[model samples]
Target chain A: MMVRMAATRDGYGDALLELGGNQRVVVLEADLGKSTKSLHFRKQFPQRTISCGIGEQNMFLVGAGLAASGYIPFASTFAIFTERGFEQMRNGIARPNLAVHVCGSHGGTHTGTDGSSAQSIEDLAIYRTLPNVTVLHPCDDVSTKILTKQLVHLNSPSYTRTARNKSPVLYDGREDEIEIGKGVIHRDGNDAAIIACGILVSEALQAAQELSLEGIEVTVIDMHTIKPLDEALVLDVAKKCGKIVTAEDHSIIGGLGGAVSEYLIENYPVPMKRIGVADRFGESGESEEMLNLLGLSAPFIAEAVRKLLNS
Target chain B: MSSIAELEEVARKCRVRIVDMVYNAQAGHPGGSLSEIDILVALYGTTLRVDPKNPSWEDRDRFILSKGHASPGMYAILAEHGFIQEHDLTSYRVLGGKCQGHVDAKWCPGVDFSAGSLGMGLSFGMGSALAARLDGSQRQAYVMLGDGEIQEGSVWEAAMAAVHHELGNLNVILDCNGIQNDDFCDEQMRMFDIPKKWEAFGWNVKIIDGHNMSEILEGLEFLKNSNQKPNILIARTVKGKGVSYMENNPSFHGAAPNDEQYALAMKELGVA
Candidate 1:
């Protein structure tokens, strides 16, 4: 079957445009509005969109102020650049539990050619550590649209990381199954499980199909929300599968792999393997080349599953 | 609106509350709080359109204390205005108290935004003003910033944004107390001619004596009528206005007054 591919940033832009109809929804962007796709909302609602002009720190604090004054603000920028405003987000947004949607596009190696400076490998980890913050990494366009729509009603601070490259559509138009902090099990197997998020979710599904060809069945779970993680589902999978392989487009130390490992070690303690960038930065390359080089592709995940089974 | 004499009486009471809270808490910034109490009293009692019963009233003017370490002054003013119970002043900085070390909106009633780290309130005020414009509300936003807080790069970013957006409803009052937590601001970072900087940022600038209730009220009136551009009042003030010993004293910046100093401060303020 041919799969339709779309970038998560496009979905974010489309959702923002739809959210613009609400008078309470205000959008703020750094100078990267065109690149981050927030310009779509800006063009539609010029009066409501604020162009902060290369000032991410001021953008977040302004977003916080808007939120305090009963406006739902979506602050957007490149994922790596959002780090420049982390303190503002922590103090101005999270500390108040203000309803601000912080969207960081071009996350991880999927951003390509921009190199490590532009890509955010540890963005998830940084936001996850903040209190009262909901960290989300959507795998496809469908999930991104659903999550962005839900964020409007969520009266808390949230961080959504989207990708620059097109990823395969993993879900139908079912917003019900895309609840935050709940893992979606794509395929179930008794032998092993592959838990992944972001662009790596599609890779995990592909790896599961390849492993099935060799009579090694594995479950694929889309762990979209990193914070407020679905600990129950992860524990259930650990008990049933007895072996696990985690993959992501971020650094293995603090992304999806780190979150799952930390949970399992304390509760389940099964054989596991983490397939992601290992203590190294990304370089300028095509998205596909970077994913392949960083061992975030299907073949690499399959290799990890094979190695885990043999071990 | 209250008369200048009435406003001065309210400011005197706020100053007494400021010193008492800091002394009881045993850990709070007193010098800057003392310096800023008159301005806070002027706004809460005269300028700002706030209802103690409805703290989150839509269309009400919003105030953000950017120099949040001086939260004792804000808390005292809020209590005086009946936004919070006067007895809560004794619980300042204590556990299970609404008055925290820094101004927290969640814990304290009538606080439009939480602020502790410097250089954030102006941006937040600008945002609130923008939100009001989006909603077609005529609500104004008042931000109190410390002179030392201007050294932060983020404050400049916010200043630029406010001008770019042409936020006429946003008013920033720079409490130029001259002293910071460590020492005098000029001794640390020489900010020569502060009023010119605001003018350079496209703001309608006014310099006034911050401690004088009539000057503060006039500045507020000027900002209310100046709807063509964003307005900033650079109010020159002594670090510790009422207490002679703590005046311009960096040691009292973050320190609660000792017994002898506390008695002397109360006597000087005529609150003894």
Candidate 2:
């Protein structure tokens, strides 16, 4: 076991560069190309890149227009700033079922020192509510690259959330194994299962490893696609493990934890603990400090699993 | 090409159809529809290079009704141009019907984009124009925006982007009908000196009488001949132009005329 760390934004930039070879693939940005890493695509194909000049709503509508005219447009902005264009994305892109890829970078508290204004703790929830929108939060660089490429072939609108901080790469470039609406079972254990997305997948894996030493075998699953969730896997895990612990780098209200809990409560009726940000906003801090302060670190997740087991 | 008189006759028929659909549906924006019908007739009859038999023709010029609340006008034009059957106009706003309350490209043929939310049509038009430019296609993109819809911040965003991209194939027709949903635009948001505002945004601006067939054709010709910059034709129009009682009346902005008013409107348009 060798470990490699890379920001999910890097994966997005690299994947965009590769996708830029296709003339139909255009990239639109809202004046945050450098931070969102869409500048890589701009550098490669300047003609194909559209700078929307700090207008997220216009960027969304423009992307919809391009999609309507037989072009696949990837519209990128800060995850928090995507709220400015939510209505445009809903009405223009999702409502029409256009093939536009909305990439929201710096998702969640992992955005670190940029503070609450930059962090998007509710982007997935907002996008999930829109009909015909595929909401995805890739776990690490590898998954992000895989999913970003997959978005090119998808004919419906999709939202992909990437993190600003570098997380441990969980895959070895075996992208063929990843599917959009399917969950990847990283570690299988019988005691309890931990389902997480975005940067929390690595945290959940670390928690599973730490809990394994104490004779508590916990299964860790990467539930990346929030909308069109992998129900069969979740139900199988719930029926097998009996207890479920969900973790994410977002709010506990309507993120991965909320989606998982809502599904299990209805279908399986299992006892579960959701580990995420409670109703409070995040502040500027180092990435590791923010994760620890927000109780999203591996220890916090393991503690949550232990509590669920004991109860 | 249709003569000015012939175009006016078509516009008159479309105006009749607009009032009829709105009145039958029991809910619709007839004022803007009536104001914009003549402009649509001018475009559909002469300017646009579209095949009604092949609504999705790849090389066809794209028309987006950005002021989407005026769907009755667009639907009438689509029906007249043979893109959609005339009987479909009777099902305006009916559940699971082709004629939706707003212009839905999915349900309506010859509609280039879906628009109801204001200020988005310009952006979509710019995008289509940019796409055509990239593909080296001769087709152009035309977007019809409401006078009040320009107040939306997103419209300016698209305007600026269109100029920045230097989208020469993009044409925006602003139906400056004076009134919005509640009151006169000047009384509501005070969108004064709109032509100068567009000129300042780096677009080639043209002011035209929207209801006059000759002025409408001249503006279209100017746009078609011009190159290097995006063009915007600010067509000054009377709200509910053909219908005498609803003319310049803000009350008819989103209200379908009652039976008495509908009959009077039909008589005024000579379709009674």
Candidate 3:
């Protein structure tokens, strides 16, 4: 398998430049164009891009207005800064059911040295609670770009979180594999399924490969859309594997783990373990170091899977 | 409704409806509603280029009540402009009612914004203005804000952005009614030299007595003629302008007028 590495933010920028072809697609930036990779689109379409300065709250509503006016507006900022305009997104956009695509770049503890403040471990959780709001956390650049382009056809609002660090391009040439709400099976097995999202998808792949070498064949799923959880896929994996391990770079509570558990408990209860940041804040550190410290690396995922299998 | 007398009569009728809706519902902010009715009446009657038959007309000027709690004023004027019937005013705050407690575009007619929160409409208006500019249309986006509502930090963010974007198509109506939900604007928070603040932000500011129909028309004319920068009409008004007892009274800001007081308010506005 040819492995190419790229940041999901770069994919977001690339997708924006592509979406610029559509006359109605406009980009909004809250002074994070460079960081969120929206600068690429801004450079090409300055008239269509709205520079909102350092006002995330204002940027969100501006996007809502554009959406209301029949224009598809995409706004981007840091993951944590997006939270600053959460209410605006909820009231002005989601309640009105405006199709404003908001991309919160540099999500999760994997965002590294910008520290706990910049690393938004709760964006997915908070956004998932909003009605008519779609939440996404794609694993790699290819997947991110594919999901973002699909937002143009959607008449509802969405919150897509991207990362600052690069991950293995799992869908390098498999552009047909990614969809907004469906999970993609990276590695297939029936022993115990490892469902992960965002940066943790690569880690889950590594974990599955390690377990396969030991003849303990494992399943790896990239559950990108957290809000609209692919219930059929989850139920399928749950029924086949009979055991599940949910992984994410977000908090263990109200994230991918929380979402899966909530659904499985009422519909299909199975033995499960959620691998994530134990309800705690992150600190400034290297990407690999942060994952290792938070016990979110491949070794930790493999360890959890092993423990679940033994139990 | 082009003449001042005709517009004043419209304002008076809307005033009756404003009080009637809040009084009948036994809920809502009647003070700000009464304060803002004159401006709303003027805009819908003489200033705004809108087609009541096509409320969602693509080229129509956008009207956003950023201080959305004062929906009665908006609803009343909307009724006067034939956007909604006076019969629809009966649904104020009712279940499955089009007239939501807060103004909502999705639920109601002639409402461009589905608003409940404060300091949000300006940005939305700015967006609408930008969209108008992008489309090369001559349509304008109008937002109404309360004196107390300016305290929200996000409003400043948008105020700066609107000026920076040079949104000449965006117009703001500041209903300086001097009162908030809790108390007067001075008591709650002193928004010192409000005109200077807007002027400092590089906006085109015009001052007027909000309840004066002729002055409001002049202000509207000024906003319409402005180019190269956004404009704000600072309309100094009395909270509960039509109701004698509720006038300048903090208690009436969020409270409903009693039946007796409602009758008095109706009588004060010369409503049969």
Candidate 4:
């Protein structure tokens, strides 16, 4: 696809403006005007954008009401507020199939410097557990933009997890196939398929490049869409490689690892090593420092894959 | 013909179904359901201009149970009015039953909005009222809320919006049974002078004995005639009403009446 380097929040802002170009779309935010990247749309469509001023639960319920009234609503807030509305999202929005898009900024450790609580590692799990909710955590800004637009068109309740800090652009319009529930293989190999999502896709690619030099042919797949996981591709890769490695910037339980493991166990089980944050809280530190401290770098993923392949 | 006497009989029958339905299923929120039975009887039987057979007939009045735990009262009235089979009442809370633990639109007929969670009903009600007005429909929207569930901040936001828009078609009925699941509404959270507070929020307020069918019916009629202001009827009622032992008791808030308790309550309600 024609991917471009834009800030994920900015992509969100642009996609919202594009969404608002349609008269049926309405925008809502909870006081984080600039952070959520909704300020641009708010300024352009003041009548359509309604700010709830940090009241997350009310924003959710009101969005649900508006949705029931036949308006496409994009309700944005920080991950904490988005997580706080788990019940409202489940009952008022998702359960009834209310066409409300829940845009949660700062989804994973990419939020950086903030502690584990703000990282919202459990958000994917929380949203995935709800029936009829489609969960999407894009790899970069461009994917975020495309997915946001696609979700608005889908007319279903969706969660788009975005990052706070900028990272190197991975897809510079070099790809063609980006479909929901379909993994994009950045590299080809028979040794193992290092499936990853969010910012961890970049890490898995770097690891694949390094492992290739050591005579270790590694395949990398970006499993961006978490729910409705690409089970077919995952099982195919698992069968081809005899081993697999999954990584994400989220918790091990209900994040990428859990999704991959649950898929494999049901269809094609293989030796797997999970490269992500363990069951622990995050701490405030520099972005690079936290990444290194948490052992989420390419070296760690490569090491885990190497160990799994050998074992 | 005294409207009060007629409504009293309806309320009595509502309580009978509530006790019987809950006891047969061995599960359901009997306390608040019984407490709100009179309000439902008064609204559906005497006040609200609704054709049960034609529930989604755009011009029919809308009623939402914001405190969804008390949906038994709603189901009893809906079934009695022939919206659904009255024989389906005994399957309350059972798997594959038309009546689940809470109001489910997919499972039951005439259930406008599915609600299992508390505090979301008012905002939905407000939205429906707004949509109706925007579409030039004359039907009014009524939402029944629990006293404790009013503590949810969304309810106030919805209240403020309803007032700001002057949704004359919206009527919020607060089931002031005083008891929540854990404690009495006043003890758990003080909602002193609820009608005055709603008035302060720019709503037309009416305080009445919730159990008194006459007051409920009168309040409903008065609300329908209003032009530019939404109505909030503050109905003070016993938490576990009708049953002698469960009356005013917090324990029955979500408890299903046992066989003996059901028999006694039904006998008192003149069921047998």
Q: Each candidate's fnat, in order?
A: 0.93, 0.85, 0.81, 0.48
| List of clashing residue pairs for candidate 3 | none
lDDT of 2 by residue, B1-272 (tens): 99999999999889989999999999998999999999999998988999999988887898999999999999999999998888999989999989999999999888888888988899889888988888899899999999999899989999998999888899989999999988999889997789999999999999999988999999999889556799999999999898888999999999988888988888888973
Please tell me how candidate 2 rates in CAPRI terms: high
Candidate 2 per-residue lDDT, tens place, A209-282, comes to 99999999999999989988999999999999999999999999998888898898889989999989988999
Q: In model 3 chain B, where is the ten-residue run with the lowest total lDDT?
A: B257-266
lDDT string, candidate 3, B1-272, tens digits: 48898888888888889888998999999999999999998888887888989998999999999999999999998888788898999999999898999999989989999999999999999999999989999999999999999999999999999999999999999999999988888988998999999999999999999989889999999998757799999999999997899999999999998878878887888977
Candidate 4 chain B superposition, TM-score: 0.95
lDDT score for residue B214 of model 2: 97
- Please compute and give the TM-score of the first chain of candidate 4 against the native first chain: 0.95
Among these predicted structures, which one has the highest lDDT?
3
Model number 3 iRMSD: 0.5
Tens-digit per-residue lDDT, A1-311, candidate 1: 89899999988998999998898899999988887788999998998889899999999999998988789999999999999999998998988899889999999998999888998999998898899999999999889988899898789999999999898998876667998889999999989999999999999999999989999999999999998889999999999999999999998888888899999999989999998888899999999999898888999999999999899
Which regions in candidate 3 have their CA more than 4 angstroms from the true location?
none
Clashing pairs in 4: A1-A175, A1-A176, A3-A173
Our model 1 lands, by Cα RMSD against the true structure, at: 1.3
Give the Cα lDDT of each candidate.
Answer: 0.91, 0.91, 0.93, 0.81
Q: Which tens-of-lDDT digit does each residue in B122-241 have in candidate 4?
A: 878876776566557787888999899989887887888777667898998888888988988778889887888898998888888988776777777778766688988888889878
DockQ of predicted model 1: 0.88
Candidate 1 vs candidate 3: which has greater DockQ? 3
Q: What is the lDDT of residue B198 in candidate 1?
A: 90
What lDDT score is found at residue B69 in candidate 4? 81
Top candidate by DockQ: 3
Off by over 4 Å in 4: A1-4, A114-117, A153-156, A171-176, B1-8, B45-61, B126-140, B152-170, B186-190, B199-202, B221-230, B243-245, B256-264, B270-272
Supply DockQ values for each candidate: 0.88, 0.86, 0.88, 0.47
